[model samples]
Target: MPSPNYFKPSHPPTIANVPELTPYYYDNSIRMSPMERAFFTKIAKKDKSGMVGGSDEAQFFRLLMHATGAKKALEVGVFRGSTTAYLAQGVGDGGKVIGLDITKDYLDEVDAEEFWAEMGVADRIEIRVGNAVDGMRKIYEDENGSGTFDFIFIDANKDDYDAYYEWALKLVKPGTGLIAVDNTLFHGAVLDKNHEEGRAIDTLNKKIHADERVESSMLCISDGVSILRKK
Candidate 1:
């Protein structure tokens, strides 16, 4: 159900972004698969920025897949294929995942082929390195206008999020399909309306909120996640 906005708050609601809260929450939450834990540990150790989604958020992707019983999924960004692994697992047996990335640099850095194989999901996933929009366009074209995906995840170039969402709407199954956009809040930048990416995300958030074709919500999760279901 969509969140109700019936009452106006007298005081501004406090948003939580404490550093210690992560460890505390992860400690009490459900444990990730051993492979997910190891791969995430590697990402956290080698990737200084920690841009990749954390275990809990990654698990949420898997949860979304299960919730919708998604058999075919698309991930728009494949940074080191960390979250891609979870997406692959989420699709269950005989399912497929298409991963699109702007470059193979990160995948090469991590030996993605061997990594996905080690994760036991190599055969079910396909990696496409190029412009994400073009890749999605090809998929839509190849699928003959009919929605070819049950789930689509967008975590690519923030500036192009609106474009990606437009394409995703065309590719995902109507009513049943789900589209998830990451970093919707952009580190709280959406609230301040600073920078190009933040402004882009803010615009999309508002558009999705008002868009009558889909039902959506912005979750206050890691960096903020927005889920949209086509009507």
Candidate 2:
């Protein structure tokens, strides 16, 4: 009863075809737009670290922008500008995303400028290459030391997360701005208390939990994203 094509070497089945990868997730997941898929594919091929956020996570960022009506956003880490692109889309026309990365090597490798141009959001993105803290500080100072950002995302080095949070608190709008910290779970290492990176995140988590200036939630999305809304 086998068909002639039964043993044929066809293209690999993805979530669109094989819903069995994670039945519940695949069944209910929101599908990526064509542009999003292309960007994701490009990053998957170029990024050796495999650290890019998943489509779901990227969608969450976009949703956050839409929900908050955020026009000005900042991303502390700009690895290949994958999430940066989503953030740019979330901000919409006339909005801006300030991306800070330690190096432009990854961005250059991925032809980020060309891709962003192709997506029609190149003008909305501003890339600053330098030490994260220094870059953030410069942004903070350039704006005359006031909280001006509607949203700020932190995904840089774990050791500097606390410092990044400190600056984020200073840069985001008061009483309404949102701050998102990625990798808060540190791959469940925070639970085991065995990893140095995990310990650092745990420390920051406790600090954020205790801080009264923001209402926070630890969303169990990709790698655990902790979102804080300034009060």
What Cα-based lDDT does every candidate model obtain? 0.83, 0.85
- lDDT for predicted candidate 1 compared with the true structure: 0.83
Candidate 2 regions exceeding 4 Å error are 1-23
Instruction: Give the distance in Å from residue 12's predicted Cα in candidate 2 to where it truly belongs.
Output: 33
Instruction: Report the number of backbone clashes for model 2.
Output: 0
Error of 1 at 46 (Å): 2.3
Q: What is candidate 2's lDDT per residue for 1-231, written digit by digit as tens?
A: 444644743643344356476657844886776776777788888746567766777788889889989999999999888789889988999999999999999988888888888888999999988999998898888766468898899998999999999999999998878999999877788877778889999999989989998899987677889999888
- Candidate 1, residue 48: Cα displacement in angstroms equals 5.2
On TM-score, the candidate that comes out on top is: 1
Error of 2 at 18 (Å): 18
